[model samples]
Target: MRASRLRRAFAVAAAAGAMVFSVAGTSGSAASGMPAAPRLPGVQADTLAERYGANDDFIEKSERAARRMGDTARADHLAELAEPGRQFLSFDPRDDGLAVEVLGDLAHADRVAVVVPGSDTTIDTFDELGTRYAALAGGARAVHAEMRRLSPDTKVAVVAWLGYHAPRTLSRDVVTTARAQAGGAQLRVFVAQLKQANPAAPVTLICHSYGSAVCGSAVENPASTAAPLDNLAGIAVVGSPGMGLRSASDLAVRVPLWVGRGADDWIAGVPHASVSVPGATIGFGTDPLSREFGARTFDAGRGGHSDYFKPGGLALHNLALIGLGHGEAVSHD
Candidate 1:
């Protein structure tokens, strides 16, 4: 139950079989100087299902998981989360294995949050993100419900993007090497799918831990030949070491980037970690507020890494604020 144990368990699992989906970082291919991905124009929500056809398996899986939860409200909430499947990316079963779940009416929502969860994350664990083996409807679902409960009237969409191949160790195999290249390519394509679902809808890329690494790499080193998509309203990274860029301005999206780390995050204590990342070459001692990195630094109190998105956690509250365009004012204990 210790943080170190949890982090280690995840590392072992990922190194073995992709860790299902780590709520943590991967050793990106960027560490070794591999080129990023080719950019694809984003997709609109309306025609996504008709265009891509990537949602059947995900929809069936989510529905089955919801029924087993034994909680109607959660089942409904999960159903809501998976609703986005009908809107974006066509639920491509063969497409890089990225998972998608949507809550609220994507066609009408003013603000949308695409949640890219970190290590040990998976499509089936859509609700819990590896909290417990029997957690069919645990952690992720609870907070997702809280999001709706806090503001049912607000047309907010919660996406559990458990897709993308993550690293097994803190090594460069998945993260720096493959994830950096393949992740950006998939994301580029996904963004196009999302835009097709709903154009001009403000997108807030909410990334966690290793997911942050994916986000940074996607933006900093976009595909060599493609034009960039529309600006994301915002980018939020919690419990992050640093996005792959030397500074936030380096990100291609031309959006405001924000970062926070739960005070107790053991990742901050890991020495020579990011510095070890090869190509993108981010080193340790990365300050979220470094002017060199154009992001706004958020002070996320002492919740530790995994605790960032937990109920009543300061980081989660911050995420809600970022989600609502309310800025980072709310603070949870």
Candidate 2:
């Protein structure tokens, strides 16, 4: 059984690697003969509509450039993403990467949820406009909808943050925390800037899969003197392999730490261990949902790996509960 799992892991990784190359290769602005997107407005904007307008203008320019370069598919894609009312905090046509969008009114939000996605999440696959289960953007919208459904009076916002270069499942990079380290720094800075703009709004980070490693890295390193992420109100890691830490204590954060995993998630089969490679340590250590690791485990239901944010699913419900500072109210298995 152990050998079979290892074989499956490698097979999945290989398949993931090839697909990623094809998708990511399409994102190069110079290679595609498209100009770079303009610099985005301040991400920490107090007026949500104003920020959306600025980003929309840049998206339109980039889309026009793509069309001029004869890449109509990309141009069309950008047009859909730039639809007038959508709230985009940033836009970069470089790697088709790191576009942040708010699902609700960020300006008056009492609570905010920042979604950190896992592997295979590029801008191309990040926003499949109408499909709810296929993309991170869909999941973020679902979460926002659920929050509104459950608590109509509460003003909440969900940020779909494709803020890092996610690794392919089959690549060697996936085995290491290297990418997570860089992503974590960016996330930390983003959260800090968020606090600066909305001092009264509490923030919760919803990390999925390898994105948990990014969240973990952003907090105290234990080995370093860097301060912990005290600005966050809470953090929830779902379908996590591990957080690049043996225990939650290693994160050194003051907020409540939550963990959950779906019963059918293939990640449950991956051995929860970390090893040192030539240049980096591969794999995150320790199962986060394990009692020994000490996270508040919540119910994620019987969905598969990518089903956590399903509109009416228990996982999404629990996530909404946690994001609203009702962690204790979250249902468990």
Q: What is the TM-score of each candidate against the true structure?
A: 0.67, 0.89
Per-residue CA lDDT of model 2 for 102-159, tens digit only, reads 8887767899999998877776677772365547888888888888888999999899
Model 1 TM-score on a 0 to 1 scale: 0.67
The worst-scoring run of ten residues by lDDT in candidate 1 lies at 26-35
Clashes of 2: 1
lDDT of 1 by residue, 1-333 (tens): 233443453355446554433433321211222122223234555544443344544444544554554434434533644654343332322212245555556666766777765554433344554453112223334345566766777776655565576543444343333464566566666665566667767777777776787777667746567545573677888766556666776677777677887767886754223433324433323445456665776767787777766766667667777776767465533
Cα RMSD (angstroms) for every candidate in the order listed? 9.2, 3.0
lDDT of model 2 at residue 84?
68
Off by over 4 Å in 2: 1-24, 27-32, 39-41, 45-50, 129-131, 222-228
Q: lDDT (CA) for every model shown? A: 0.55, 0.79
Q: Provide the global lDDT of candidate 1 against the true structure.
A: 0.55
